[model samples]
Target: MADKSLNKTELVAKIAASTGQSQATVDAVLGGLFDALAESVGSGTKVSIPGWLSVERTSRAARTGRNPQTGATIQIPAGHSVKVSAGSKLKAAAK
Candidate 1:
């Protein structure tokens, strides 16, 4: 199976076409969505776009790991990472 792909321009065009809005408007709306996501993540808040996806933070406990190439033992400091989970509606739509 081949992977499907769509770029930002294609997405903007699709939104504009479907909403009968100007391309500029669609672009602005998309930009706002990205900005909101960034802000929410920065503030340590989960962002959920219903019928699309949810973005949240997950933590990793401190651990020891081996350096793959050098085979040297290293301590991996605990850290927080962002996780994105797809929503049920999106899963259904893709099927």
Candidate 2:
């Protein structure tokens, strides 16, 4: 487990400080970035940042599942899901 986690506010503050921008501006930029990302990914388009991250939509097939409480079998419907991959730069930062 990590000792400390940075939330959205802290992240916006850090970015604002590093870029010499106001927190409000940084927050708006972040909001726009997320909105764009969601729009693109929701439309089945893959989003990639060369060395930082990639996100895409994936399809999950319908299948049988078990109900744990009743120990009964059930059918699970097909669904779409999002997959996020950390790119080389982000992976390197962890090392």
Candidate 3:
């Protein structure tokens, strides 16, 4: 089997063809959606598309860590991360 990963451009083209929209218009809409998602997540807001996916910001506390190369101990600082979870619909689609 060949690798069939879909990139942004291909995704845009596919959506455009399916929706009867111009590729440029589809790409712009996708871009806007991504921008909105980023803005919400950056502001610590959770975003959920029911039966599709969910994205949220997560917090990590500071802790101790190790330097693999030197085997030395180091301090790990607290930080935030984005978590994405696939919903039922997405999981079902993969099967």
Candidate 4:
């Protein structure tokens, strides 16, 4: 069976109706939430939206990597990665 889904337009419409706000306002709010999450992750801070998801920064150790095109060994510098973990409620809903 196909999974049920709602597109951004539908989601914004529903949120606008429920919150008594315009669709533009709903879009702005959603955009703000994503912007905040991104800013938090960029600053190496964890961001959690209750009943939704959590975003955190993780480090990758420096290692040797191979160049696919040239087949040459290369050194990769350690860096930070953004990790996202879904909330328990979201996991339950997926089932």
| lDDT tens readout by residue for model 3, 35-78 | 99999999999999999999999999999999999999999999
lDDT on C-alpha atoms for all candidate structures:
0.92, 0.98, 0.96, 0.93
Question: Every model's Cα RMSD, please?
Answer: 1.5, 0.7, 1.7, 2.5
Worst 10 residues of 1 by lDDT: 1-10
Runs of candidate 1 exceeding 4 Å displacement: none
Per-residue lDDT of model 2, residues 2-95, tens digit only: 7999999999999999999999999999999999999999999999999999999999999999999998999999999999999999999989
lDDT of 1 by residue, 2-94 (tens): 398889999999989999999999999899999998888877899998988999877899999999999999999999899999998998987
Clash-forming residue pairs, model 3: none
Q: Model 4: which residue pairs collide?
A: none
How much lDDT does candidate 4 score? 0.93
Q: Pick the candidate with the highest TM-score.
A: 2
Q: Alpha carbon lDDT of residue 67, candidate 4?
A: 100
Candidate with the larger TM-score of 1 and 2: 2
| Candidate 3 deviation (Cα RMSD) | 1.7
Please report, as a residue range, the 10-residue window in candidate 2 with the lowest summed lDDT: 1-10
Taking all chains together, the TM-score of candidate 2 against the true structure is 0.97
